[model samples]
Target chain A: MTLGRLNHVGVATPSIEKSIPIYRDLLGATKIHEAFDLPAQGVRVCFVDTPNSQIELIEPLGETSPILKFLEKNPLGGQHHVCFEVPDIHAAKAEMEAKGAKVLGEPRIGAHGTPVIFVHPKDMGGVLVELMEAPKREH
Target chain B: MTLGRLNHVGVATPSIEKSIPIYRDLLGATKIHEAFDLPAQGVRVCFVDTPNSQIELIEPLGETSPILKFLEKNPLGGQHHVCFEVPDIHAAKAEMEAKGAKVLGEPRIGAHGTPVIFVHPKDMGGVLVELMEAPKREH
Candidate 1:
């Protein structure tokens, strides 16, 4: 199998509240989700639905947040990572490791409520990539 | 209308030749376009077709290639910009400007052969956003 589809693009923002207006008013996005904190991930996130994908806006939750370093260099905010869907995250991780790509950690529940893993940017040509298991559809 | 769809993610690479194997053999991508130079934009580009979108691999075309600076900061390369499709480039430009987002330059032809413009990263929360007119689909 191959990459399933683009799930979302993670944008690291200093203030999700400040950024919400741009996506909502300027871009005319109507399907934006309410902001929620992912305590484990140490970031507050909300999804802005696009025609084919979502923009995941993230803000550091507290001190020692993983995204703090990213924000330190880019105080205003910046694109953090690009997330893609995979039919099976385990298989996707296996395949990537076989090609010498560094899988950050074991598959864990991600913002999408699906098993996900991050690949090191160095391995993916300087782009931090997130691979999530595609959500199953019920008939 | 809202952002039509994510068209492609532009990645700056030192060498497109070197990155192809990872996306193809590793990621199982099969529909990669041949690499070509776009002197006007000061870079070479190639598209790796994903299931729902594309990853545009771009390399500096010459000594004065604009991407050279990005490559310097990220010697191994990095995600440069994410492009989205719009129904009307002019309307999108107007909406962004009205919202106080700086749209760079006049709309011009982009790598997709459609009129496109870039929103300054400062205005876009540190992520350079490219808005391209949606390409016509062939029946």
Candidate 2:
């Protein structure tokens, strides 16, 4: 599977509204998407784009959320994942699993109607990585 | 100061040799440089390069090394820093510091003679970031 580009960097924080301004002023990113109450994911996320890459700010909605638990000790912040744009998510997952890498989730529909798969950190030397195939734009 | 491109992603590991094959096979990167004794920093490092970016695998040299201490609890793997290429390292540091980001180090020589400085995670939402400027090439 061909890796296209570095898609985005994921960061887990305490609050998006508080963090957005800092990132915007420093990185010059514009907020492209914002959503709340993603109960299944247990967090609210805002997608901000810069010229070269995108930044994902995730804030936990409930106490039980993994990100919430992560923040208990590291209240300052945490690196979530480094996503890579792949031409084919399924093909990439298959290749990774074949090479003794564990696939965290099977390819499924993710935000923005794109097919994405998460690879476990255990397989990738402790860095959680995501492989995504962008959605086709309809005319 | 404008961010040029991402230079390298630093990954702290227990053993650079153990982790090299995985990155090589998965990311299509080839070994470019290896330093077994960084007495100044108390660690060993191997640089792997891909077409667009590089990955730095660092392992502590002795028990007293900070990386060795860090690996004790986070043995699975984790990011050390995400460095961005800049035209001027000191200028970038000054700009980031003026914006309230804590500069970890003054611009100094790092791998390949590149002048670099680190920004503390406190200001970057827990992600250790480095600013780097290219070295002059000799004939």
Candidate 3:
């Protein structure tokens, strides 16, 4: 059970700028990473780090983006996933699959280039979850 | 900046037994705590601990509970709140208020007799976050 610490909670919002102040000012988080046009995921993201865990705010880049659909249904926004830091994302995925849980994302590059995967919400009783192996910290 | 770590992520579900196997076997979580008929909150809760963070499954006791309303709005269950392990919940609440965040619970006793306060989602950009303070052993 050499799991790492939980890295972050991913949130899907319509705009990052609108969400930043709540995290930075209210939660005492600071902007640590930012990226845009993730063509693969069809969203732009910004990561804010508090003393405890990171907060990832994502905004859809196009009308066709899955995030756009999510926002349409949940205009007020909803949590995307509660991510847990794991030692080996690949191994975790394998173990989860063996237990009959549906795995969504395979071990793959995620925000900030960390290896990550998702356990289906249905399997977890309706909470989307992500497992990530910490990537190299960047300044 | 010694803030607390994320203690757990709460989720409102329709059933706890159905959700256990996924969390325990698939997500590698172990059942650490269980509380039933919390009249104060009108829900039954089960705490599942992973190596890094805990997962709380909440089941509404009746249709009168607020969680029941949340489920009615979004049939698909979702993440509820990010619970942070703080050192002084009062200090955390005062700081949050000073920074213009609305306090929900206002430093009250929570699930495990820990002093806790909830920052309103309206103040957190759609993320319901709880600040908890009380010395407790890590699982």
Largest TM-score belongs to which candidate? 1
Q: Which segments of candidate 2 are over 4 A away from where they belong? A: A2-4, A27-40, A48-51, A62-64, A134-139, B26-39, B49-51, B62-64, B134-139
lDDT of 1 by residue, B18-133 (tens): 98987887677879998988887889999998778888999999899989999999998888988889899999999899879999989988888899999998888888999999
lDDT of each: 0.88, 0.72, 0.74
TM-score of each: 0.95, 0.82, 0.83
In candidate 3, stretches whose alpha carbon ends up further than 4 angstroms from where it belongs are A1-4, A35-37, A134-139, B1-3, B134-139
Angstrom error at residue B122, model 1: 0.6
Q: Give the TM-score of candidate 2.
A: 0.82
Instruction: Give the range of the ten consecutive residues with the poorest summed lDDT in model 1 chain B.
Output: B21-30
Worst 10 residues of 2 chain A by lDDT: A27-36
DockQ of all models, two decimals each: 0.71, 0.36, 0.44
Clashing pairs in 2: none
lDDT of 2 by residue, B36-117 (tens): 6665566687887644566678888776786776687788767777777777777787788888889986777766568888
Q: Candidate 3: lDDT over CA atoms?
A: 0.74
Model 2 per-residue lDDT tens digits across residues A35-96: 55666667787776644566677889877786877788779777787777766777888888
Q: Is candidate 1 or candidate 2 better by DockQ?
A: 1
lDDT of 1 by residue, A1-139 (tens): 5756888889999999999987887777778999999888899999998888888999999897999999998898988998888899899889889878999989988998999999999888888999999899688
